[model samples]
Target: MSGRIDLGLLVAALTAALALSPAAAAPQAGVMDARAQIAAAPSATITNGLITATVLLPEGDKAFYRGTRFDRSGVVSALAYKDRQFYGPWFDRISGEVRDFAYDGDDIVAGPNTAMVGPADEFDFDTPPGWAEAAPGGVFVKIGVGVLRRPDDAKYSPFRTYDLVEPGRRTVKIGKDAVTFTHTLAEPTTGYGYVYAKTLRLPKGQPRLLIAHSLRNTGTKPIVTTVYNHNFLTFGGAALGEGLSITTPFQITSGRPPSAEAAAIRGRSIAYLKTLRDKDRVSSSIEGFGTTAADNSATVHDDGLRAGVTFHGDHPLSKMQLWSIRSVVAVEPFITLVVPPGQEAHWTYAYDYAAA
Candidate 1:
């Protein structure tokens, strides 16, 4: 017990915690009834045609797990974690308990542990009610350029400058019968924050998608930022070595070799996409994106297939971390955004998906 959190130990701790904690409310059960939804569901049951194999994040207002049939059967699909508890109280106030979300059978895969799934923060663009997980202000927004170095001083303070410019939630139309739920900000979390997500209803629907925007302040006073998304994808019943295909046109900026644990979690993640060029597939016609005041943009044509995602943020290199459990992939996007107490920054990324 070195005190450092390891996956196995963390899993056990989470299990025990959930096993002992009595549910504040009864588990909701129904096919399409919103009122019959719940935060935690037993992994022993089934949803639609999939089986609920594993339960992740059993300790908070949210608990995420997988459906039957997909690869990595019974895995975590969504949850939240923070480096500190100072903000826990605030988060507990505005955020709602997690709900059951089914996935669309076409195009992409999904998994447990996807951040910001289900509904938007009840407070919408309002500052968090309190610091529950990552202090009050530390909301996964990493710092530094190229190298990620969280600010030393104001690490997890409250988000004093954070404000909600936009108050209503809107669904973005994506292909036929496909839409994403999002909340736009006038005074966004960083510079301009757009969270694109959805709540899955059954087997023929799509899981939620979240794309957070933040900015970084360079020493030259040049405002640099990046756009990142913590997309949790699952391919239920699919194996890791099946040569999962990803098509994209953006440049592969880096290659993050998988950790030994990552290799164990899922084999494909062992060869993650550090940079765009490293991808096994690509589009010759598509190039880069146009420049905007906040960040750059790139276009990725899937050729009617499920391709990789790309973004332009304030940071130099757009980074993505691949986490997996056999059939699912969490392509977490991130950039250097300086929210160092007094400094201000922001960035954005536009994302889309297609079925291969």
Candidate 2:
């Protein structure tokens, strides 16, 4: 492959599952009653009692996700551990049809704007600095989203939602288990800016959840980019093809392999042979990992709720891949963000949970 892998790891190889299948335990059985039935936005909830999480605060039209394609600063959601529930809400609403997701009738919409859900993190995801030579009233730069407006180019679709012009300086604290998000921008007429920060901890007793990041290169060009963590692993809402699976130490070879009836990479694991119906998918391009960071940690199992979670990274992996559709299963991992202007770059990810 050429990309993917990065979800969060370390729970002694957690594996002891089952329990949580009410559409994935209905947002941990009442996360403010499913955020008041999805859409009141402004969220924050962290529990150290045993891994309980939720973070989504950008509130504009109740920003659950306003689509610009990820990195809406720490926008996590329903991530239970013991009671079993890992990541939730995998598209079923929010559409405009710009580049990615779309369904309409039965729900599931994520296009033109509304690119959402957990582990959401992206930057310069395929052309974001002027989106294909900006023209049409020019302007571009999407480091945690801000300063966009390249309306009409026909190409440059991170699920199109452009036309913000400026959406920087955002902040959110909320602690008790941890939650911090920051964003800043300058954009000297397209020099690219940043200050980005993201945090989401829960380490009290330790079921695990730690995702820290930093980026500082404050404007004036020189922020070569690449930031990944789309690991939408949805054990909650579990149902993405036969009991789910994905375990990797490094041996996934994929020259675009995906769809051997669904999934099956073998060697280091990537099973799941059937269950993703209707618009089904299982993308690939996850080559053999090497070059450090413990060959890149990864683990995800479900054997029908016999839960598992492990995805760690302290930097090194520059790309890895795996995508699963039918309610999520992303193994995305890519990290490389050279800073220059002012310089500063950091990466961290950890997640470990299990169930019995």
Candidate 3:
């Protein structure tokens, strides 16, 4: 008899068992009488049974500033499910040194900053002349929508920036099952005319949070861009060490395999190779995805806390990346879309938390 267990086969067997289990036979019931409120500070909070989420109002707290004086809105700081918080300060804080730059004959300078999440369209910045010579203190601001040259173009690059400022929000109740926080950005800034809206919802009884977003190109130009959710997840203050596993529906292919000393991949999952010490890091850009949104789901299980979170995208994934350090773990999912003039693009994401 063999004493060693084959992890890959074990996972396969367990997956088969789950599919046949009675618990998977029907949909679970959801919570009831869920409600969302806006505090005096203008922050928004949604509470339903054991699930609660606080979305920091851009006007109230300066914690998640994007390091830019212009377009100082449209960022949400913290989201929590019980004791587990999904977002936090960036791993690297910006240096305090301030430098000056000239944009459209106006002087621009770096502003007070902190880490941000879910900012979009990262690859559309114009490297200003002498930008490399300036002091490195400004935080990277990479959220917007626009059209640009495709990857294969070699001669010209159309790197445009947009200012989708802080949105206006309202709360709405839908039937008896869920409450939604709807945020809208209607006015165009920085030459982009578009209608952008994001809704955050908490359903009754279900241990999940839903985020739905829509973008309409009201301008005369077509909007060709990619958007991603930069999920900065901190598992209830649990350290990023051993007993952490990331599971995907499909095989993973990265530029380099997880370090043998840090993590291992078995079947369709990746688990920590060993407990990571302080300052230890693991980062990678992963591929190997199918053609459907169901193929783009992943789960992060924290064995130490006996809890986990599953992230799902309702749109086909264009790319995926992962980054982790001592403090936080980020799983980024990218989606590509094109909105012709007078057309719109839409997508949804859901986060479900569980505990053993």
Candidate 4:
């Protein structure tokens, strides 16, 4: 027998040795470990190899829009990405109190002296015929969507509650790359008979999410209202104060500018003046938007975390507002819908995240 093995035999032996080596087994072992860890994690949470998130179901009794009696039933909680949170603490504010308004039979007598709600069309249709002129005092009833109006404009209607029926939720995975959460709500009564649906998706291996919405008027009356997402952001569990800023692509004309001690606008961005103390707040409405949704987009950045988030929509933004207090920063983007009976309208929004 030859002292050395033949070349073909030697090659075969080397190949067999490599196949059994630790390096060759490491990849599969690592994968199995990750899978085991994920399987052990809590249910109500999602992870896509890159980011992890928790799903927040409606609290049933918590009111989304302060003062409104309607319960919140939808995807209404904080979104965590890149080790940072992107929502305000739930139940952080007091319930919005109903304002006094006098009613004389079917007509309002007095009380809501100023326009405290808006988007113009909702103020016209959602509110009673003569809310502003109603007698100086009367009973209070929650009736329309709550929105802040310009202080100088008494032409709009006062804040009222919109009865948001509890939303039905369905969650599913799309292939191996994404997960989708759908929330559907329909007006239970003949009043407002508007059917609303929203689908939120998180794609695997990406730093972005998508939200699609549809509204249909199922009643005999036309449904004219404005819908907006109040993105209340709390970065790294920090309050809204110094080191936080917001930027837009166009010039901003606020309905209410920030106070001198809170923040200021620099070029196309709003920079915090200082770390806000408790009760300190900054709020404003951003004007200067075109008819297209592409023109409406904004970014909220936190210098302390070196992280930021961008929000954009697929439909025209009828209005935009910014509000922040010591605890939360909210960027509200409004869309106007004029769906006739049996008609429907659709829109979508995208959120992108980045970190340095």
Candidate 5:
């Protein structure tokens, strides 16, 4: 067996000065396995032998800007939102209504038609006259323009977009005999007044099992942002015979609080998130009850027949986000319910695969 410290140093050296395709960058970390491969910039395969997992990196070096660690205890991943592009309206906005502030899945542009967001605009909240209602658009544009983009900066407001960067590359390191893969972003990008981002990848080598991780910065200035991990999984036309069960530290709120409308979704309806269809998509909440006083941790997972999946959060993260893709569940942990600035410490999430 290889020493832990030695393995880390060796992988770091090989990925230190590496750059690959902008659509899907794969650094020759080790070997490849047969799960699936897509023509994306930041994706990984075993360069030599068979491994249990593969790492998928997003282009534009935006995947790994958040950190450099991979998943071994399980599949590890992070959620990255660059610049003021994703922040929505809060406080005030006369011309821009709440609908313009919420996030619509259309603009995400992750794949041919896949989006981190659902069909409807999520996160649209109601507020007083000064604090306008958010429908769902671009968070950064809503926050930046509705509040910051006053007549003073209205001119430059039109130029802001969430497209982080054109694209980037990704690399992966397959550990020996262990279900671990390390992914690193090739470069970073600038947006929302911030100049940092890395490529992130989600590699699933086993049936109904997957892992992911990312590195990112909220920006040098304070910007209200919400980091949500949206996962998309499936059962290949399988029925919910055993049904889907989720466990989290938070007590799970019944409905959205008085402050947010979009979050005003009912948890009881979607708690078990069985089968998801295009029309069955909507925004909801997964309230945490363990500890909300300050930054804390939360763990969540689903019990799958013959197996199960678990996700955990470590330091730097405080909240979790859940979205459904067809039959897949998007699990996201956040630093703050609403990220302002300089709030990032160290955060984590895990995907544990075990027998049912």
Candidate 6:
């Protein structure tokens, strides 16, 4: 009689045990599963031969950016240029338990309250209409996300995901080189509504991507807010450390500054110093810009990859900020939108990519 145990059975048991371990638990640390989640997500790809961008479409049952934070439509999940990838997942995985985000070793993990990628935009985040007046169960209007039910009497916060009351109507038009999303939302309870259309286009022969937006007030209420794009930029998953530089036309000043050891602010640039490990962070509320559209421009470079992107907008800069963790760096630029009933406002942004 042979005394050797079954080799295949032993291997399978060992694998199963590892899978059941706490450190290997998924939807948390075992976040490689995000690959499957992204694959199953519905999206569209647009390219101009120089740059290729894939946007996650909005769906009631399986939307890509399900969080209540950013505008869901035109969510760019992936972008590649010159064989270098940008705007990929900065987190290991997305979870419902995470209030906002938590540092996990080399990766940042996000919760349903704030899980998104690429240049995601948001409108009037600090003051969603009807939030204060709405009862605990009543609903308030969030322009891009839809109607959300008020959870409690607590002050409004972007760190928590409110229950969805309605998503209104979403229409999508996709082309080979461009894609557009139009959201028509009318919340009678808050007396606020609008027709918001956002278009992402890749110029035919240029290494540039453009985002044009038009917001038309369709309801009786006036829509006064500030809309900003969270330019979540990265280069091939490079750490947000040395060799990274962000430049703006105007000199840079900040009300809230980042760690001097992590980042340094020169005359017109935010310079990264040493590498970010563990729970290190860099963030600031950038100020000092005049009322000119030309001032609303920034150029970012990663010297290691010899690649970079420049972001500019047609509207004047109302506010700006810089933020980063270990895996991603974001330059947030804001513009004011004031549309009265039956009126509309328009703005545009351009991103030019370069690699040498």
Top candidate, metric TM-score: 6
Q: Over 4 Å off in model 5, which ranges? A: 1-17, 21-42, 46-51, 59-113, 116-225, 235-242, 256-283, 288-304, 316-321, 337-344
Q: Itemize residue pairs with steric clashes in candidate 4.
A: 67-96, 101-138, 102-138, 109-134, 109-135, 110-134, 110-135, 143-161, 144-160, 144-161
Q: What C-alpha lDDT, on a 0 to 100 scale, does residue 17 get in candidate 4?
A: 8
Q: Find the candidate with the highest lDDT and give its number.
A: 6
> What C-alpha lDDT, on a 0 to 100 scale, does residue 228 get in candidate 6?
91
1-356 per-residue lDDT for model 1 (tens digits): 01111233223213111121222211212232221122333222112222111122221123221111111111233222121100001011111122212233321212221122211111111122122233433332212101111233353322222221123222222221112223222222333332323322222232212233322222322233333443344332223322333322243322443443223222211232222211112111111222332323332222222333333344443334444433334444444443443354443333332333
Position 2, candidate 4: lDDT = 10
lDDT of candidate 1 at residue 226, scale 0 to 100 = 35
What is each predicted model's overall lDDT from 0 to 1? 0.26, 0.70, 0.50, 0.49, 0.29, 0.78
Candidate numbers sorted by TM-score from highest down: 6, 3, 4, 5, 2, 1
Provide TM-scores for the models: 0.31, 0.32, 0.65, 0.63, 0.44, 0.89
Question: What is the C-alpha lDDT profile of model 4 across 3-88, one tens digit per residue?
Answer: 11122222222311001001100001111121222223222334444554443322222212222322122332445666676653
Error of 6 at 239 (Å): 1.7
lDDT of 4: 0.49
Candidate 2 lDDT: 0.70
lDDT of 5 by residue, 46-142 (tens): 2112112323333223332111111111222211111101111111111111211222342111211121221111111211111122223322222
Ranking the candidates on lDDT from highest down gives 6, 2, 3, 4, 5, 1
lDDT of 2 by residue, 29-96 (tens): 11122334344665656667788786666644445565566676787767887787778777755434
Model 3: lDDT equals 0.50
Where does model 1 exceed 4 Å of error?
1-228, 235-241, 246-315, 339-344
Query: Each model's RMSD to truth, in Å?
Result: 17.2, 20.7, 16.3, 17.9, 13.2, 10.9
Tens digits of per-residue lDDT, candidate 6, 92-173, equal: 7776767888866655678865677899998776887677778888898888888888988888888777777777777777
Global fold similarity of model 1 (TM-score): 0.31
